[model samples]
Target: MMATVRNPARDAVAFVGVGTTPYLRDAGGKSATALACDAARTAIEDAGVDLADIDGICGSSVPTVSVQAALGLPAVTWWSNSSLPFSLLVIEAMNAVFSGACTTVLVYHSSLRGAGGSKTAAADPFRVHNASDAHGHNAAMTAESPSGTYGYCAWAQRYLDTYGVGRDALGLVAINGRANAARNPHALFREPLSMEQYLGARMIREPLCVLDMDPPVDAGDAFVLTTAERARDLGHRPVLLHAATSGRTDRPFADQLEDYTISGKEIVAWRLWEKSDVALSDVDVFFPYDGFSIMALSWVEAVGYCQPGEAGPFLAKHWSAGENRVLIDGRVPINTHGGSLSEGATQGAGHFREAVTQLRGDAGERQVPGAATALVTPGGFLWNATGFVLRGG
Candidate 1:
């Protein structure tokens, strides 16, 4: 017999508040702990709640207990310091709220350049020998050939060779993100990135250039989640997380996995679609994680946006010349906050933050008109694929 499908937690929890520190090279000499605390404090205030109201905390790259104490959160019934990419932290907090383990959860992510990130990062007294890959700084991935990351360069080469396409296929992705970043005040690299610039950027890997990767920054993003009912009572308009799931292939090792034929994101999209009660047509905005430009293209194709190996043409067709960005079908905008490429890598935190901001109609210059549904596909292939649909209305 086929297994039963159930989604009792659908829309049970909602995001009521979000806090993002300015994307910066250095966070005014503050430590990761300080950055987390600052974001957490802003999130609490944004939710219009007292510190005691936070009964749970979830994050990466920083200790949950330290954050709790720094913010003077009385006693969290649930706490976890999970892995990167941000979606895992959201899932954990959402489950805690739905399972009655916690009423309110503070979800946060901090981006810092550890010693492995760059020569500057290595020279910083604060980052000496940190060697931790909290988020894809692109430097560590280059220096060490990190697993999930460098693995994509090979895939990019294959995608190009398979499609017989030029560098413009991937160059457009970077250009589009930088164009959108121009309008986002919070983005770090807002300068116009033309196709020529993307093509000429330093080649870190054979097929992947520096512009194709995500740069590191000292930044923080936080969100306040609670029961949907309670969320309506909070300050900002609640963005309901309708469905969430992550996927991976049977092949656990990145090197041993089959490529193109099976993408973890396709599995995630299938499950998310079933639980979300909607399809691509219903989506008002799309936020595909862009830690690497190829990942965004992968999502564009993986989630039925187009056939396999066609994201280049798909993006080109959706290109808005006047706006200098991709406006899907001349309506839905992808990664309005510039994405990981220009927003600075919070892994996937920037995508979620921009989605919520768009949904709340607070995105100002980058807002998608009447955006009510947001599809956020975060993380990437080989065991990190994760995504969720948010309903704003």
Candidate 2:
């Protein structure tokens, strides 16, 4: 028998405030650092905390010094740039708070993809050029297609081939996101998406139309974390950080993954349950990162909401019903504030904000009734996945 690893810091920290800059196709002339500062200020104001009170900061894809100076913090006791997945950045902030290294911490993310900058560009300096760079890479040579669409296209095709599922199964995921986005005033795309539009849309990659992929945008999102006791004394309702855990699969490489259908989210989900008192049944809302429709579908199964290969049918039945099963009043409301797919892409930070808002009853039109518990899964690619369980305090 194996012993379970429990998080002793469970519920020790709470997200007191969340903020975001306008999700825009182009940020005009604003730099990513400036956008991050705007979001940080908003979060601090929402938390009712003075800028001087923030002793720690964590971020991904942005400079800590720039944000620190821009915010005019007196001094930073602890600061780091994880550059890891955005969800892991949240866990790092929680760990800093739990260790008494800082009292109030801010975690933020910003992207200039719309400005023609991308993660791949930033990582290029660190990557060693291979033959595939000069010659085009193929889908079968998974690890070699770092900058191409073949990797994702291959995954989508594999899922379809293995389950004998149609492309519509993936289309439903996009439709659900668009429906939720229609209710969000801040979402970039508010127009209603129809099944006909989805099926007829131009294909970016085989089996994946334009709507199935996440659009790149310039945006920033920030969150404030403090001790639960302190959070309760702050301006807004504190959403308890019940659990935060991340894990990787044995096969970390894209081309070498043992099983394409099995996302390592199962490992994250099991670990989250082991650390929290709440169960999946008690969850009132869900916010899974929708970098791609298939990624969201993988999380749906990884979290044990349905068995593997069942998400296609489950979504088809629930997503299309007249009752709007994926809405806030429906059986299990998901991505109530839209998602990266429909909402602006703030990496995974937008998902964090949605969870906090839903838990606080601050999501205006998409607010779930009595949403006391929320589950947020942030995942990308095959193995890197993290889950956060939040409860209203």
Candidate 3:
């Protein structure tokens, strides 16, 4: 039986402010708590709201209590610790606001991976030494080790094999992201990456090169959400949350995935579209997670932008022709802030920030002209997927 689809609680809540600390390779002794506070304070100020007005807080990776203490908030009536992919935090914040549990809410993400504070183990999943075996490793070891790339590489290979594409198609994704990053001052890698450079990059895993991965960094991103009426009374323009949805596949592990080429985004995208008036064609900006270049392609296909396994040709036709193709003014502007691939990884919050900025017409150099709607997917790894459709109000 098909479930009844209902429109999202449209305009019930909206994002009024977005903020982030300067992404850095190392925060130079700054703790995740401190970074979260910095971003939260900035967001609070950006929204023209006082700290006391923040009745709710939502985050993952960093504790909400620490953030509240660091910012010295009077009290928070609602708080939640959302898990992975970052988009869940946004949805949680919206839920809190709509339930009247809180008038204004803060959602944030902070990571200290690049500061050597939370370093991944050196285990390589592809190679099994006498002392260590990939299949026998515990869940903690698997999640905390750099060896995870092995699974992503496996998916990349299967994608190529299934679609009859080559490594060059993946190169196009990297090239497009780097090109956008070159124009963003806050991006970690701002230099223009040519196809020659992308193809020649060091191989991290077969078919997946160094350029295909997002570098871990120490940074924080935050946003303020409130009722649309309250948002209008605040400083910045409100970016309405038209729809949001999240889901995970029963096959959680990479080896157990039902389809190597598919990420769980298709599930979220289906619900997101069913719950919103907006369609893919109505999106002026698209921000699909690019923790890995292939992940972005997976999302592109999952969201019905193109047929499954055809994202390579679609990108080649639309993203290959320099600035005139997918830039801010192109047919489909994407990842205007360069995404996690180029914009220092903020655990996908950077994508949300850019989406709000573009909708507000404040993305100075990377602004998508007349951008009224945006679709953002913060999912990869064929699990724990979340998506949102936002409209400018």
Candidate 4:
């Protein structure tokens, strides 16, 4: 007879461990494959689980076929080779667990674009093309020709003019990230930024300065997920993967959205709250997406942290400790690892690890004390979003 395993409970999958390499827009020492493996090794080790225990691999579509081979996994039963946000990958991991497809799954990604290698007509499983890389009027990416349908500046300009958000508001973003990164040894940018300084920065696109855009980073990050019961056996703290929710807008591209002002963050958050059996006050910290500062603010509101058009004031108080301290009320502290703006974007995996670290109390120096619950939100704005709730077990 076969041994029977059942779902642990309602919202029972747990995040056992996480790891990542120092993010770099242009990493020098290793190829993207090697970088990705480095994070994978750290994650499994952190979990205190044997390599053979991992029966599944969930890889993002970026660095290419080297992940499973590098990790020496038996097979990658579950995987996503699209630029689909990392948040979606976590949901896939949760589904794998729910379906009894794999006991221990590894989710990982590493970007090789820093090498600036040329892309041709060749087809690669791990290197699925993204709209952002499209070419036409600007073969090498000029201001006039958008590489994809949703290219930079087009939506940003619309949002700015509609919201009456001035450049100074955006400057606040660069200043905040630069300051937060200064204290993060793993961060790529460590210098403080002033409003005047941000204003003077090179404008990459209309209404978007060089600093406004998420840096083109070459880095790798990985995390491991399994049932809470398995986690208890592994001797590591089990961070329960309580909820995973995803939402899509009617618009395939940014241009299709009827209201750029209409946010999907609330819809996703609502779904998560409904499924997780948890409430907003239950989360000790938050790790909402930070692809852009304004987007983060938008998410804050969308997720019911505050009312619409009130995020600026809420942020003013919540993140007021000069980017290091968590509010006493924060059982789920928001982005203690400095988020994407400070720690460098790992496609959305950076946010995932930060939330996991907080729950596991492994964030060292940046750890939130007695962090029992955390919320990890990833993905992109005006596109898709994913949220996960975890509690210390």
TM-score of every prediction relative to native: 0.96, 0.90, 0.90, 0.83
Sorted by TM-score (best first), the order is 1, 3, 2, 4
* Cα lDDT of model 3 by residue, 1-393, tens digit: 157987647768999988889888766767777778888888988999998899999988677988888788798999998776678889889989998999899999887653122333123221112211211234356444544466678889988998899888788777777778877888888778778888899997788988898877768889999999899998788999999988566776766778854446767877888898878888898998888888888878888878878888878767637472354224677787888888876668899999999999999988877989999988675666788899999
Best by lDDT: 1
Residue 320 of model 3: what lDDT? Answer: 38
Candidate 2 per-residue lDDT, tens place, 227-259, comes to: 998997898989999999886777766566678
After superposing candidate 1 on the true structure, give the runs of residues whose Cα lies further than 4 Å from its correct spot.
1-3, 136-146
Task: Give the range where candidate 4 is weakest over 10 consecutive residues by summed lDDT.
Answer: 130-139
Model 4 CA deviation exceeding 4 Å by range:
1-10, 62-65, 75-82, 114-152, 317-333
Q: Model-by-model lDDT, in order? A: 0.85, 0.78, 0.79, 0.66
Candidate 2: Cα lDDT at 355: 86
- Backbone clash pairs for candidate 1 read none
* Sort by lDDT, top down from the best: 1, 3, 2, 4
Candidate 4 lDDT over 1-393, as tens digits, reads 122423244556778878888786545546667777998999888888777788777777544356877777765555555455687777777778767788888888766442223242124323334222311122465444433323435666675676666676555555666665566688877776777888898876677776765664667888888987788887677888776777666663555565644545665776777767678787777776776666666677777877765565565556545443334243344556666766775667777777776777777777767778787777655567677777888
Which residue pairs show backbone clashes in model 4? 24-218, 25-217, 284-331, 284-332, 284-333, 285-332, 285-333, 286-333, 286-334
Q: Could you tell me the lDDT of residue 348 within candidate 3?
A: 82
